[model samples]
Target: MSRIQANLLLTLIALIWGSAFVAQSHGMQELGPMMFTGLRFLVGALVVLPLAWREWNYLAGRQLALNRDDGLKILGLGMLLTLGAAMQQIGIKYTTVTNAGFLTALYVPLVPVLGWLLLRQLPHWSVWPGALACLVGAFLLSGAQSLEIGLGDSWVIASALPWGLHVLLIGRVADRMAAPFLVACGQFFVCGLLALIWGLLFEPFSGAGIQAAATPILYTGILSVGVAFTAQVVAQRYAHAADAAIVLSSETLFAALFGYWLMGDRLAPAGLAGCALILGSLLVVQLLPLLQPAKTSSEVLPIK
Candidate 1:
């Protein structure tokens, strides 16, 4: 693919993912967060299984075996994914999609900080400024007067830590895994199963609820998880790292647009400012290396 085509693919992926925020919020009207999360992830798992199997078969043809250690790593990744997805769904129930989109972008800044703390690697100087901007943006967006943040925004903010950890884990294990698609499938299966158990324990399951939520669930599960993710995997092979990041990070903008157009959601001026800062910070963090004269190229962070 040409760079332009690759970039368009990435942009499409971002659009799909951004619109999923609206889908998730709408789905909450029919099903509880736990049930919705469980069902969507289960559907996602089913959708991706064939692709993963195809990759697994190719690896097997090369005489590669997925070992016990890789299995454990995949399980760990799944657990983290489950937590992040659960928090996001629960937060969406109580927050506007606009708020959820910008807040979720916090993970972009949080990743380098987590890498520094966990691996003892120093972040580039730009990371510090980007992180600061995100912190300030989050504070303003939270609508805190004294020190109290809204419950839903708090959930979304807290979810960023787990997401950061998930990225770090992927960075550590991705190069070692024989089949990336298979690893993704294993993690999705684990996340789906865990959410399913939580739903069974705490939320009532209803066929009627599932039926009502079908459209939203299908959008999030099949398009967001299955198609968009696969497209990202393929497109990134042909895209410049920084170009892909810039395109994909427009997800917040798309989310706000979708929310406004579809549900008439609006943010206050302060909240809008916060969203701008957060988005700017993400760009700085992603493009910083490219701006530096001595740096060869930018590193590509994995998409959530």
Candidate 2:
């Protein structure tokens, strides 16, 4: 797909995940964080199994086995995914959906920084301004005037590091692996299995609790994990990781809207201005490349 198309797909994923913040908040009302995370991701794994099988068959037709190195990389991705998801899930229980959503966007700035530090990949010049704008916007949208943070907000902030690394890893491996669905399946399974084990060990289990959270589990599992994440893996194949992060930052806006409408969360005037800044930053990031003079092959940096 073209870069524009990939970005559009990322935007859609953002919307799905934004709405999922509400579902996640509701889901934990009856279930422990680990239990809810385990169930939803396991359900997501099942939802994507058929696609993963097709991908496996296609690879077999080409006489290719899954690369050992790639398998290890995917395992690492699963660990990071689990870390990020678990922190966010736990944090949502104590924070409003609006706060969780905006705070989680801390990853937008983190992605480009991680890419540079770990892979020595330098993003386009425009990315810096856009990322700064996104960071400031998220801060304003979160409505925190002081450095002190709540426990839930702190957890969500902590999750940003792993989430940023997850994006970089996906961008690094997605094209080379050429099995986005399979990668999605493997990560989901690993995350689910680990979470389930953790939950069973320390958290109480009740079938009725699962039933009570059924709607949220199904919605997030099917849409957020199954469809949106897989699409992210595919889209990142064509899009730069930094660019994808900025585009996906739109989730903060969507989450605010959904939280206001569904969860009775309200944003102040500053939050509304923050929303406009986010939109402006997104436009600048996406449009700058198209407006710039085309670079020669040697002048272009390979997507990392």
Provide backbone clash counts, one per model.
0, 0
| Local accuracy of candidate 2 as per-residue lDDT tens digits, 164-214 | 898778755666787877887888888898998899899987999999999
In candidate 1, the residue pairs with backbone N, CA or C atoms under 3 Å apart (3 or more residues apart, or in different chains) clash, namely none
Cα lDDT computed for each candidate against the true fold: 0.84, 0.79
Alpha-carbon shift of residue 84 in model 2 (angstroms): 0.8
| Model 2 spans > 4 angstroms off | 1-13, 127-135, 230-249, 273-304
Over 104-175, each residue of candidate 1 has an lDDT whose tens digit, in order, gives 989887887898998987888888999899988988877677678888998998889888899878756766
Which candidate has the highest TM-score of all? 1
Give the TM-scores of the predictions, in the order they appear: 0.96, 0.83
Give the poorly placed runs of model 1, Cα more than 4 Å off: 293-300
Q: How well does candidate 1 score on lDDT at residue 247?
A: 94
